[model samples]
Target: MQFVIDDVQKKNLTGKAVMNMSLGGSASQAVNRAIQALNNAGVVPVVAAGNENQDAGNTSPASAPNAITVGAIDARNDRKASFSNFGQSVDVFAPGVNILSVGITSNTATNTLSGTSMASPHVAGLAAYLMGLEGLNTVKAVTDRILALSDASGATVQQNTAGTTNRIANNGQL
Candidate 1:
């Protein structure tokens, strides 16, 4: 995490880069500080809320207040995935269940996987797209735009626990 933060700082990629952190563990101040540093450097950090089925506030990186923590929902029905963590730490939800993606075995190979990690990339990609499309050049600008564009009415995530937002990441496409 610090490595990426350092590189971003060194390269002065502020407003030009978004980081997707699909990994996390228990709460760690060190990780939180790194996330803060990344935000201070002007890069948006997108993190997975974890697959613990508990409060994401207890998870590092996700718990880091500076990051845009993401939770998982099933694309088929917009229901919260059984394993996705909840709580206020999660800023938004995205499709994670049975998501298809490239596989390591071969160029044409693909695989279906599930987890908050998968959900996070959707928001990360959206962040980058927004940065490029709208000329958003600050973390605050990008974050606010994302939250404003999210679909709270369409989320309707079934079984989503208390404290988490109903908003689901959206790219503004009809």
Candidate 2:
């Protein structure tokens, strides 16, 4: 993680970098600090909220305050996924149930899986895309635009955690 942070800094890609952190474990101040450093470099740290079905506050990078912590949701019902971590640490929800994605087996390989890991990339991609599409160069500008463009009405998760936002990632489409 620090390596990636250093690379971004050394390459001077401050406001144009978006990191997708799909892994997490027990809370670590070290990891949190690194993520904070990433944020300090003006990089968007998109982290998974974990699959523990518990408060994401107990997870490491997910608990990092500077990250855009993402939780998983079922695309069918717009409800939190059964295994997704929740609570205040989770910023937003995205499609994570049985998602179709490319696999590592071969060039033409494809697979379907589900997890908060899958969800984080959805928002990460949106963040990077919005950055170029709307000329949003800073982390704050991209974050603000994402939240502003999110679909709160239709994609609101049912039974979301009390402090978690009900918004889902939207690529400028309502």
Candidate 3:
């Protein structure tokens, strides 16, 4: 998180920005602290809820209180992917299966990838867009807007914690 903060600091900007983590590991106190520090610095740390189809509370960074944990779903049918991790930790869901995007191999190349990793960026990109278009300067405000504009009705599976069902990320609301 420090390294990311340092890199982003080099670029001057007033509005809040998102730090999307397309990877995750076992929950750890140290990791949670790092995520909190990032949030303290006004970075909306968006993390993947994991593809294990298990509880996201057991996943680090994803379970980090400061992070906006993202899960996966099929955009076509608006159905949760069987591989997506769910529960109280996940903050939102996004199109994950069969997403066509730039591949790692080259700038012009594109590939289809699936997972919460692929879904997380959709939320991060929307966060950035909202801050620019809506003048949402604080991380909390941006986070709130993201959650507020989400599509909870699209979610078939509910979170383990009441009042926190995994909602789908909807960028169009901004």
The number of the candidate with the highest TM-score is 1
Q: On residues 1-174, what C-alpha lDDT tens digit does candidate 1 reach at each position?
A: 677767877887877889999999999999999999889888899999999999998989999998999999998888899999999999989999999988999999999999998999999999999999999988889888888888534546777888788888897773
User: Clashing residue pairs in candidate 2, if any?
Assistant: none
lDDT of each: 0.90, 0.88, 0.81
Model 1 TM-score (2 dp): 0.94
The TM-score values for the models, in the order shown, are: 0.94, 0.93, 0.87
Per-residue lDDT over 28-114 for candidate 2, one digit per residue giving the tens place of the 0 to 100 score: 999999988888888899999999999999998999988989999999988889899998888888899999999999999999999
* lDDT tens readout by residue for model 3, 1-174: 797777656675424567889998998889999988888777788898999998889989889977889888888876788788888888888888999978888889999989998999998998889988998887789888888877533444333334446577886533
Per-residue lDDT value at 28 in model 2: 94
**In model 3, which regions exceed 4 Å deviation?**
9-15, 151-164
Best by lDDT: 1
